[model samples]
Target: MSRSCPSRDAGLFPSEAEIARRLSQTPQEWAAKAKVLERDGLPRVDPLMGGRFWPAVRAYFLARYGLAGAEALAPDGPENLDAL
Candidate 1:
């Protein structure tokens, strides 16, 4: 068998507060997600992993909850990262 995807790994982490600021979410909400990630063994704050994580999270919410759900999380949408 052969694998074509890169191995999943993470990097140095930031505080939830820092992530909250970067993503523009309330610290309370960040803290809650952080807790869930911790409980579920999800990596939410690793700097390197975070780059991979946040985008995937954004796509998920956009697909599941729609842009309106991400309004607070990503007010700028594709413009957030200049994808637009």
Candidate 2:
């Protein structure tokens, strides 16, 4: 069955702190996961922009929680990655 989407603002990705908060994890904990994400092909860090890709974060969310869980974490709701 389809799940309810999250309520998120348009054009804004969830910050690292926000993702951590939703997962009930400390920033440090999330950072550790980010490290793994980087190793798996997500950018290590955007030196100029100062954050990882939002899609990477969304993928991580999906890996950890599945579609419904990922949607729950996304304030702006899950995106249609297929459209990208």
Name the candidate that leads on TM-score.
2
lDDT of 1 by residue, 1-84 (tens): 112122322222344454566668876887777676556544445554443355544454456454635444446534455555
Q: To one decimal, what is the Cα RMSD in angstroms of model 2 from the true structure?
A: 14.3
lDDT of each: 0.50, 0.58
Inter-residue clash pairs, candidate 2: 7-75, 8-75, 8-76
Model 1 misplaced regions, further than 4 Å:
1-15, 37-52, 67-84
Query: Model 2, which residues run further than 4 Å from truth?
Result: 1-14, 60-84
Candidate 1 TM-score, C-alpha based = 0.33
